[model samples]
Target: MAGKHLLVLIVCLILLNLSATFASKQNTTTLNEATACIDGASITLTFGFYINSCPEAEPIIFSWIEKAVSDDPRMAASLLRLHFHDCFVNASSFQLGCDASVLLDDTPNFVGEKTAAPNANSLRGFEVIDAIKADLEYVCPQTVSCADILAIAARDSVVLSGGPGWEVEMGRRDSLSASKTAANNNIPGPNSDVATLLSKFQNVGLSLQELVALSGAHTMGKARCSSFSARINSSSSIISNSPDVNLEYLQSLQQLCSQSDANTTLADLDHITPTTFDNQYYVNLVSGEGLLGSDQALLTGNEETRRIIECYAGDVEAFYEDFKMAMLKMGRLQQVNGGDGEVRRNCRAVNQLGS
Candidate 1:
């Protein structure tokens, strides 16, 4: 009986060892899978991504952009807006990543974002991108990605237009697809109310403070009369009823945006410093001189947003600092890095072979 009990005990010990070994292997596999997923997602793109591969890429881009902006100061704002529009599309799960999808022309199977309602005839700066890309291709072949070019151009635009500059994280790759439906749905409209604008920004993980700071990009751009004529012409508009709007400003806008020429006439978004990038946009908002209804909505809608507008109006340095950080954060959204995407040969079209 004692011998039988010893045999049973040995058998139980063997089974226990087997179970332990199996659990150990299972835990290791789970850990490895988790680590790989984390590594894939956390692709930290640095500013020196092209230091070895294409040393002169940034300098070449800077030279062309500097010349372009020197000839046309408005090109800075256009370039900056191009970056914003390109990065703002729905990039999370849909792979509409910040891959210069907005620059793609419409193909039969895929409709590009360039002609979306908010972007049609409004978004400029494509020629500037083409010029820079052509120069880069000559110098570095396919070493640089259009996504990186757009990001760098945006940084250069702010510096040229007298705003603070930040180091743009590089190493992003271009997407193989473009989505007009995503662009039309994602890009905020000029007539969007404060709630809608907040929702759009929040959808992309941006905060209200960031939204207010980024909106200050309007300091250097011009809005067509069609963008805001309804505010002045429509009797029920908040601008018509609010005493905050300067009467003189209203009269000037009315004169500029007559019904017949609403589409052609353009007005400076920041009348105080029309051609410069500064905190004057926030100042304009404080005084009810904001160019678009969406611009004014910052002050009129939420207390926190209004407070931010007031703070930026009073503190230029704060605005610049916040704007720099906000832009960097926006540029980092859903970026394609590592071997996840490819560097396109043409910014306007996807790489045909393997992107």
Candidate 2:
């Protein structure tokens, strides 16, 4: 932890000269001054929702996350993606927004979100959430919801990865069901164009600027070879008509993916700082080194998205502020009002009746 703090200090110092403030609704440093948050179901979420029922909720979740990320730096990115996946997919009537449906395991009756195109073979770190949920159930059975665990874990993951911290509004309930179909159709894909990306964000109440800011999460993770294969594959037409990318950079990606095991090979999203949670993703995009077509689309997209991307690339502080705001807003997303939501004793399965 001390090492990460020192690293953050060095990064901030190096980039402070390039700082410029973007529009922000509240000061991250002053949590009390932050605006109130409510879920899509119209349930008011508050800080410290488990202060009395589960006083150790946050501490326990943080301890497990800190350990997991320490043991595997990639775990931080995985957990962060969990919250992101959990927060979206509301396009159809299923609307499993931020309800932890992504954590569900398939049963004999229904398929879960795990096998969705966006989630299967891509998502990880579920065991960590299971372990934390087991401990929370032992400490205060059914007091802390899996949805809340995901939100808090996402925040702590960013903090541990040397990014800004924000208060995660709590009191979210776990969804009783999961939707593989919705996940397939709703979650944004790496191949999506800028218009589809912005439309999806708006469908869920996020702004175009928030889409740019939230995409900054790409800084900490990696992408599969399939994710950007079209961007540089000489045989594919996405290359000739694609946005300008550095020649050497495109060649390197092509070489990496051309390997015999290309299907399973992974490429760092931010080649400069693969594991750090910083605005370097934007910086890389500015250089035309963004890993996904969806990412480079931001640069080639309309003026507003491009302007915000450049703002973040030049201003780390501004990026951090907007990211916190966006994450907070995303954490509050909920699709259902009341039916079939519960504080599950197990994250992967709903409680049996009369247990």
Q: Top model by TM-score, which number? A: 2
Once fitted onto the true fold, the runs of candidate 2 whose alpha carbons sit more than 4 angstroms away are 1-43, 91-95, 236-238, 241-243, 335-339, 353-355
TM-score of each candidate? 0.85, 0.86
Task: List the pairs of residues colliding in candidate 2.
Answer: none
Tens-digit lDDT string for candidate 1 (102-219): 8888887688888898788888888888888887888798889999999889877887787766556688888767788889889999988889998998888777777888899999
Residues forming the 10-long window of minimal summed lDDT in candidate 2: 15-24
The CA lDDT at 13 in model 2 is 43
Candidate 2 lDDT score relative to the true structure: 0.80
Residue 275 lDDT in candidate 2: 82
How much lDDT does each candidate structure score? 0.78, 0.80
- Model 1 vs. true fold: TM: 0.85
